[model samples]
Target: MSDSNSILFFVLGCIATLALIALIFKHRFFRQQKYLPKRVITPFERKMFLRLKEAFPQYHVLAQVAFSALITSEDYKIRQRFNRKVTDFVLLNASLDVIAIIELDDPSHIGKEQEDAQRDAMLHEAGYRVYRFTQIPTLAQLRKTISG
Candidate 1:
């Protein structure tokens, strides 16, 4: 075969091999796709959510919501920091303003108190009241906070 023809075949073979590798990786990635349930909250969170709704019936209760969704800033750098964190629950008033934030502190969060404080401080700076409950609260207890 002519040198040119041989070179052409080699180029085509290299391209085909690369394409095959790409396809295999793509197939493996697709196979790894997992189907997760919609709810991301722990069992304790669900209980608190119900109580929060009962306490503030007129308010909107949100679970596992991102901080960026409630607060917005024109500064990109400032906004990006909030985008990375999610609150356990957020209580919004009728006009969609954040009335308060509830953070559940289970055993898993014991070692992360500093991290939690930073997040709570940021929320507080944004003029939102934050309530951190170490144990599960009752409907009466939650209601008392609203009235007090």
Candidate 2:
């Protein structure tokens, strides 16, 4: 091939390679991020959340909410320890103040009793009422607990 034609072919090849690189990057990196269908709480927890809302119609029900937002501590260790923790359900009165924290003691919590106790204690120290239920509570039982 002539020198000019050889140089022209080399330039075309470089352009094609760059276009291929750009296409590959677009395919690999430009995908839109999105949320998938993931359950925030278990089926049992869902039932309990609904029941609590029914029991206290005026209260706002929050399920699987972060503990760090609900309560804080002055101590760094305490803050770090519970920063990433989550509560099963939190009930907020009309004023949006936390009225109570309801934790479902499911099978997964069996071996983690110590952690649960510590969590309950932490909430208590924070001046919040924490209620534990092995199974979903009856409307009457829940009302009685809330009232008394």
Candidate 3:
């Protein structure tokens, strides 16, 4: 074979090897990104999420709205018994620790105040604070909540 042909083959072989390596790494990355059940967020939850994100600009962006769940991670757990699968926005700081669970209470949820309270209690009991924002409070209230 001509020298040019031999060089072309070698370059092609290197490219193919690199492509295979990249595909392998990509497959492993996706494979390790374990999938969990989706969370559903209510309309009220959506509003609350917007307010929270607006209020706390430092706590990362709002997560996707799924049923009552937003963003979740592999380490999320609830009550130390069940997984902390949530709907609505679950905002976090750089630490990866959940900063808040923003829940919006629609008429139904507000009507079932006891149930709401119970859920919040459970979250708090499990060391997860629930940020129940009904009316979008002023920035002052937000600063207080976020700082305190």
lDDT (Cα, 0-100) at 106 in candidate 3: 52
Off by over 4 Å in 1: 1-35
> Which residue pairs collide in model 1, if any?
none
Rank all candidate structures by their TM-score, best first, as comma-separated numbers.
2, 1, 3
RMSD over all Cα atoms, model 3: 11.2
lDDT of 3 at 123: 62
Q: Estimate each model's TM-score.
A: 0.71, 0.81, 0.50
| Residue 118 error, candidate 1, Å | 0.6
Lowest lDDT sum, 10 consecutive residues, model 1, at 30-39
Q: Which segments of candidate 3 are over 4 A away from where they belong?
A: 1-47, 61-87
lDDT of 2 by residue, 13-74 (tens): 99999999999999899867675788788889989988998999989999988989888878
Question: How many clashes (backbone N, Cα, C below 3 Å) per candidate?
Answer: 0, 0, 14
Residues 1-148, candidate 1: write the lDDT tens digits.
9999999999999999999999999998767658766768878888888788888899999998888876778999988878889999988889998888889898999889999988988888888889999987777888777556
Between candidates 2 and 3, the one scoring higher on TM-score is: 2
